[model samples]
Target chain A: MAGYAVELRAVWKRFLGPAGETVAAVKELSLQIADGEFFALLGPSGCGKTTTLRMVAGFELPSDGEVLIQGKPMGKTPPYQRPVNTVFQNYALFPHMTIGENVAFGLQMQKVGRQEVQRRVGDALEMVRLSGLERRRPKQLSGGQQQRVALARALVNRPQVLLLDEPLGALDLKLRKEMQLELKKLQREVGITFVFVTHDQEEALTMSDRIAVMDAGVALQVGSATQIYEQPNCRFVADFIGETNFLEGSVQQLQGGQALVELPGGLSVWASMAQPVAVGNPVTVAVRPEKLTLRPLEAPLANQLQGQVVDQVYIGTDTYYSVRLASGQTIRVREQNNLAALRQGAQPGDTVCVQFVAETASVLTG
Target chain B: MSQPRQSPWLAALSGLVYFFLYAPIVVLIVFSFNVSRTNVVFEGVVNQGPCGPFYWYCELLQNRSVADAARNTLIIAVTSTAVSTLIGTLAALALQRYEFFGKKSAETALYFPMVTPEIVMGIGILVLFSALFGWVNSMLPPGLRLTLGLGTVIVSHIAFSIPFVTLVVRARLHGFDSRLEEAAMDLGAPPLTTFLRITLPLIAPGVLAGAMLAFTLSLDDFIITFFTTGPGATTLPIYVYGLLRRVVTPEVNALSTLWILVVLTVVGLSQWFQQRE
Candidate 1:
């Protein structure tokens, strides 16, 4: 087996819509998922993440480029011939078969002996915590149980990779969180590559070892959750991952790794440059809401702004204050509800100072 | 639970509708046991009650022509139902799963036999078979002969019955999720294995219902059978028609009562199976 379990080399997919117009679903997308890695493709609907997963599973053939499984090119291979299994969005458990039969389907297809099939099916069901209910039909089980059965069915095959397309999308938020941890644990125990696709950012962040953030049929960035969140490479990546305050400005000077950006109202701020930016070039400095600290206007800080608190929202865990700067730009600041006495001191129309460090803000060129 | 009170007019209307529907059937059942040979009048003198309960039933059981006609009807019904169900299920699968040129036209052709008047369909089949047999006979040797008989009647029954089977099975296919098949293939089952194990069992009820309908239709057909049959291919409906041409007899009523029971049993069985699923 190769170091990489699955690889897509510059894959492209095109479809003709119902109106006879061509649509590019996935455009020159290249990704390599390593063995025993939990990789996530995170994107919203119409971003072609699902199409990429389908190509690797052999459900779709790429219009251009090649798909390789374990370093062997998959050319015109049917889904049944591929060494992979998928947990569909709807769970897709066989309505006519019992849970046991559904789990044993892959083994029976390989002409395994009856005793071995029975033992493996039992063990798989037990692994999913559905051992006693094997004889029950899919309709008789709850949605979460049905999802477990789908997972067991796919995992029992012990394929080189497992593809999950939004498997937790149908569940409620509480159950989705529970299954997120469960799925990660199972992936580690099985030691097989899991290629998961989801539109939920939190799910991708919490579960994936690495994430490929996609938009408009293109992968914008691929990195760890902390890397993608803290040090976004572009304006879109910074905006999409979490809430951020963007201050548009022109670069005044570049010294070492820091660029000085001059905002409106003659306010100069230093930000760490993600890419090289020449002097006088347009740039945007992005600072996370949580990284900004609110202090009294008289306090002196390295990177400080004088702003008035225009609006305040009190959520249970955190309070958000929308501060309007002297240049008429509004930026949000999130404060944890650690001290109840501190929240009563800040109110709308009150002048406040926002303090942040130069390393906390990232400079984006485009 | 408290029962809702029925209005007087609604109660009367419901009773009248029931009477209108079942009065002829009741009369038929009652007269099947009449002692008189004639169907129109009771045997007892004026204002007398029915004379014997088992008289015509016994007569019908001993009739050789009735037995032969029953055998022919059973053969045609069973054969046509089996053949049409297989063909119609394949047609339904094709229509549901694939797209091709002239698909709409083909679907419309399937419904043509169902909507056309029975007399028109019977005449069309008669003309078509006669012309086809004429051509074949002209090409054959002199001693061998070809004629319209049981084979023609069975074929005509199958032609009309297929549309009904297709309609029922297609309705079942509408509720089916195509992802189940994809999931099967994802788990390493080939296309044929997936269909046999997953697709077939899910749609079995619809196929059975279609077969039952086809069998009942073939069993009771009169116009098409009358036109397509020859000397040795008289089915039950045609035999009853022949008996009616001379005079109405208690034997005819007895035979009709038994046929009603068979049809009811088949329909009831189909409904039971469908409800069970």
Candidate 2:
């Protein structure tokens, strides 16, 4: 197995829109997917994640630059010649073929021996936990079952890389969660590089070893799930990956890789600078909701903001408090419901202090 | 709430519509078994009990001209259907997959024959073929002159049937999920293998339906065949028309009934195939 299972070298894809305008679906983008890694391309619709995957699978040739699979440049190579298989978003199983036939299609196309094809198909189906109902047509199975068949069909070939294009986008939330875990387990067991594309941030966070957050045909940031969540690099990444409270301010001073930012209401807080910013430059500080702790008014914390609790949303596992700060900005604070006895933390209209460790906040430019 | 009952007037109106649609077919079927040779009136019922269920059918079968015409009809229908299906399916695939200049115009041209008046289309084809044969004969040797015949009729049938087949197959392609072919190709199946193993089977029902429709249209064609056919190329419909012009015989009714049966069988089989999907 190669170190980099797939590498997209400054790839660019352009499409002609319906109005005859040139639309860049993917700009000059470069990415390297390591072998046996569960990498996710996370973005909203039309962010070119699917297009990038298709180019890797040899379905679409890049308008510029090159796509290399296993360190070989793929120029004009058709999809059939590529050593990769795709699980389509719609689970495009052959409706005319039975489940077993669908799973065996790739092997049959490769002209594998009959016994080997049978054994592999059986094993693939068993891997997806669909062992008994092989003779049934694709339409006879439920959506989740059909999705599993699609996975089995592609995995039976044992391609070097598995490309999944939002394979769980159609399922309900509960089923999607189940399949997310199932897919992660399957990827680990198979030890094949899986490039998954999805718009669901939570799904990507839960299932991916690394994620590339993309927007408007550009990869905004690439990092591990925790790195992306806890340490987003830009304003868009900070906002897109999860909920975060932003405080627009100017840098007061820079010292020891940390900068003091002055907020709107004469409040000063320190934020770790991932990128160097000079003093007195405009910056945006981002802090996650869960990172902020609700404390009583007189508590002496290193970084604290006085706010009035205006709203409380009681979800099953956690309670979200909406606090109106003195700067006229509303910030959200999430508290886990850990107490056995029902004890209200802060009622609406009560004054509270929102505190956070200074180093937990990130300073972003632009 | 109580369910509303069907209005008596609406039910009667629907019944009238069905009667209007099926009355002629029912009358034709009833008269096909008439005992008398003349079917202009109920003269056979006054003297004889009724026409035999098989007498005219046997008589028509024994007639050499009718037999020849039936054979020619079958030949023309089968050959034209096969040719049209192949060409139309290829055309449909091209239309579905590719974009080129004048593609919209080509799609519109495909639908022209379907909506044009049959008489106008027949006359147009007749004129076109006459001019074509005239030019061909001018170039040929002096002794041999091209004229309209069975081959000409088959060609004309294929020309009109291609559009219908294309329309049917295109409808099927509309519902098809294109990702299935991509998946096949991704799984190491070459383009030809992907088409044959995946696309062809998935679209087989549409192709079969289109072929069956073309076959029935070619078998029962009258106006176009009448204008395009020569003496030796008389199909079953033209033969029956000629028989009607000479004398309205019970044999013509028997032939009509048999034609209806063949058409019904073909259409029913096509429906069965389509519904299986």
Every candidate's CA RMSD: 2.9, 2.5
User: For candidate 1, what is the total of clashing residue pairs?
Assistant: 0
Candidate 2's C-alpha runs over 4 A off are A1-3, A299-301, A337-344, B1-17, B43-53
Error of 1 at B60 (Å): 2.1
List, for all models, the DockQ compared with the true complex. Answer: 0.78, 0.85
Which predicted model would earn the best DockQ? 2
Q: Compared with the true structure, what per-residue lDDT tens digits does model 1 show for residues A104-191? A: 9999998999999999999999999999998999999988999999999999999999999999999999999999999999999999
TM-score of chain B of each: 0.92, 0.93
lDDT for residue B240 in candidate 2, whole number 0-100: 79
How many clashes does each candidate structure show, in the order listed?
0, 2
RMSD of 1: 2.9
lDDT of each: 0.91, 0.91
Candidate 2 residue-wise lDDT at B151: 88
lDDT of 1: 0.91
Q: Give residue A187's error in model 2 in angstroms.
A: 1.4
Per-residue lDDT tens digits of candidate 2, residues B170-243?
Answer: 98998888899999999999989999999999999999999999999998899999899997988888887777
